[model samples]
Target: MTIPKRMWWQNSSVYQIYPASFKDSNGDGVGDIPGIISELDYIQSIGVDVIWICPMYDSPQVDMGYDVRDYEDVYRPYGTVQDMEVLIEQTHARGMKIILDLVVNHTSDQHKWFLESRSSKNNPKRDWYIWRPARYVDGQRKPPNNWIGNFGGSCWEWDEHTQEYYLHLFCPEQPDLNWENSATRQAIYDSAMEFWLQRGVDGFRVDTVNMYSKGDMVDAPITDPKSEWQFAGFQYCNGPRMHEFLSEMNQVLQKYDAMTVGECPHTPDMAKVLKYVSRKEKQLNMVFQFDVVDIGQGPYKFQTTPFNWGLPQFKHAIETTQNLIRGNDGWTTVFLENHDQSRSVSRFTSDAPQHRVAGGKLLSLMMSALSGTMFIYQGQELGMVNFPMEWSMDEYKDVDSSNYYKMVADRSHNDPKEMHVAKTSLQHLARDHARVPMSWSDAPNAGFSAAKPWMRALDDAAICNAKQQQSDKSSVLSFWKRMLQLRKQYSDLFVFGEFDLLDKSNLEVFTFTKTWQNKKALVVLNFTAEEQKLVYPTEVRSQKSELLVSTLDTPASDKLAAYEGRIFMLES
Candidate 1:
């Protein structure tokens, strides 16, 4: 048998840092590049090879830095461009690569390009953005189309100066850039991507990569009769020119041998996803698929409806995803929690006080054993969980969460019962759950800042903080350290192995096997609070197997403890 060669990214792990909540220096209550530089050693200790920092470019921070005002300059709150250059230098000095968030699909309304584009109808840069005339119905002016934005309201925002409406798929402050123009595409490559690569940046985590090409400007079908605006993903996501533009961007990435992972939402088709990441396509190394995190999301915007999901459904989502990218060339990203998602321990498994540790360990084992590049969001290693349900709407600072709350309040006319229900659902599904400050220690502000943090820390930071867990041998932090070490020790099996999910119908357990050459390993996870005995396959019952790792301290046994996970190496 011939062994296949793997790239640096395929064999490595990525750590995502939402800079604003990571760590704060200068007592500013906001995390900055200098603070990130101070914590490089700590991040290196987790055995991650790449650091994917969210956008720190000049921005109005309307979407927490996703709205880029200047691709070349660092955000004022994050520090200066020199600080970013030092970050790239320090990261490379440690033998680790750093990637920045690329948000070229749109730019902040305050960006010079946008300012010029919206300045006048005959401006040379007018074609840089998507602009259309307003539609007048019954002597009343409405938006160009009935498409709804991701942040709520009509996608078209009227510009008084130009007397035309501009399309913003997200917040109105983030005006979508028109990719149909050759000048726009070239400008993004020169000013956004190559400029960073020249500054020693390794790669990028492209934001909304698939939304670059918008389909025909038309009204979306009204899925809900109650509302006039409709979801526009079908018309805007994964559109006609997506692959063409990605391939063009890939040409720039290829020059520096840079790694690229794209954020592709609303693209549920595996075939379409394969085109974005397949080795033959050469557009992106991998793309984030949201099927798993989106398991319980409702059809409406922001998932305001009640959250309902189970282990079986979750397993099915994973199984389907794992099987689709089975070929040597096709690859995917393995992640449970991110800046846009709630904590995995709280969402996928039990976050009850007694089971939180075990739940965290189980998820760690699952993600480590999966067949892809694993991404660990900051604070995830400490088993950090979501804020308590008692938190009021005022405590939530995420724009999406706030927008959803106001939408629900307006529709229900501020009925106390309706508002209460919305709050309860947001408790489980809001993006703010993941945006809380990282818990570094039990100190005030969770050791994230000397001053009051921009947002509150998790209530249990006293127990879940990294400093508290660092000294304890049995802590989630220690387990994560050990688990990542184990993955590196068996990279051939975990990184290059073939994945096969076993017992697909089982609700309380998730079982799978990874095989590479003559080696085979089995991973069993009990997803419930109660202990359960696993039934092995007939072919494996007689095979000699050695226990490799387990969430529980007890010796290997037939029964699994609550939320327990175990891995074993079976003889080939």
Candidate 2:
């Protein structure tokens, strides 16, 4: 495999902004584009090269902007098209790029296209969406197949007007589009890409990209016949024409020198995934796989009875992804926290007050040193943790979490013990944990808004807010700034080096080496809250080594502090 010449995107770090929870400027309790503009300096201060704002398109926000109604316009609460134009201009002036979330797997039921498609079976736009007739079973009408949605309930929703059921892999309001139709695909390009690309935006974070090409309509396999969520993932994921669609999308990106990173869920085949991102294929710059995120998942991703923690298991998953694309032309997008996952500090490390900062630094360093682009979620630099378990169900606002809670309640009715466990699972793994308004200051609403916030900040925002961390030299935010500087200084070494996981038998510690040309860099990380000594290989001992960076202010010889990480540069 040959190393390709570095591009601007390859060398830059990404900061993901969940628009609604980032900052609110109108005192209307919702974040807007101007709110983001207010924080431009704060984002630039952290040294990130790109800002990926989540969908702010026109919609009812049934899925918090993922359900797009107008792909070419901004949501009213988030500002207008003029505001977005200024945002793009201001972002470029600051020497940083901005990308918008492209959620095209489905369209809101309110969309003009959907409205036309569902108007009548004989409508010219009838084939724009996946609509099927209901089947009769035992003298009762039922859905066409046993497919289930990601947000709960059957994937098929009956439309009284058309007398047919429409497929929705997510919320029923978000109907799946028929990518099999060439006209529909062209509309996606025209609205989602060409319009935004012409406005001077950077690229896109393709939502559910692999689901664009679904297979023949059929009843999916079932593991638990009684459960409401059927195993229909294969029916709409990584389908036969997935690569073809992505390759076509790449043509649009290449014309504008833009980049794209696709969200590829439930796709375990590395060879198949590589096909979508290989340089030769020209499909995408990289892909985000959930191997590491699925560490604690049960048979199904959202099942309550997930496996308990074992550091070695996590290490194996990360190393597997690293090795998969190390020497190949395929690239991986490395991240631990995002809009839909739990915070990394609480999920992957000991979140005790004493170790939180160290653990945050360790994880940031590990991801930064890997051979791919790094994505930093908003507030992650401040070492944010999950919301307090004390929050009740009413306090949570995510649609997916609410739907799952009702499903669990119906299945395990009147069983208080089972209900409690399921609630705890939601508390730890729900998408809303990362969706709370960012903690910008210690003031009310954590300074995210002057008015009441749509979602309350975590209880510990007083201590974890960015204002507090920015003032303290030893805070996680400060360490993140330093880490970004180091990455910029060693761009080629970190982005082009070959990775090798070392001491795999050592469960408590994670270690790896990145070698490029005649130089080698070793990264050491301790997963526990207890100090440990490094056991260097014989080759490392003989090299001329220089201390590069460490989580601790000062290290005791050969010893690592609780949850500490360190990097060493060796000259051969």
Candidate 1: list runs displaced more than 4 Å.
1-4, 301-307
Query: On residues 1-572, what C-alpha lDDT tens digit does candidate 2 reach at each position?
Result: 45577678888899999989999999998999999998999999999999999999999899999999999999999999999999999999999999989999999999999999999999988999999998998989899988878877889999998899999999999999999999999999999899999999999999998999888868888877787458787778988888888888888889999989999888888888888888888998888888998788766555755337688888888886776676678787778989999888878886778778888998988888887788999989999988877899888898888887787788889489877887788877888889999999889998988998888877788888999888899999999999899988887677667788878778789888888887789988888888898767665767777889988898877888888888999888
State the TM-score for model 2. 0.97
Backbone clash numbers for all candidates listed: 0, 0
lDDT (Cα) of model 1? 0.89
Candidate lDDT (C-alpha), each: 0.89, 0.87
lDDT of 2: 0.87
Write model 1 residue lDDT over 1-572, tens digit each, in one string.
55446788987899999989999988999999999999999999888999999999999999999999999999998899999999999999999999999999999999999999998999999999999998999999999999988988888899998899999999999999999999999999999998899998989999988999898878889887888788888789998999999999999999998999889899878899898988888899998888888888888635545437777788877866676567647887889989998888888887899999999999999988987888999989989888999877889998898988998899999999988878877887788988999999989999999998999888798888888787898998899899999999898788777888787778788888988788999999999999898668665778788899998888446788989999999996
When superposed on Cα atoms, how far off is each prediction in RMSD?
1.4, 1.5
Least lDDT summed over 10 consecutive residues: which range in candidate 2?
298-307
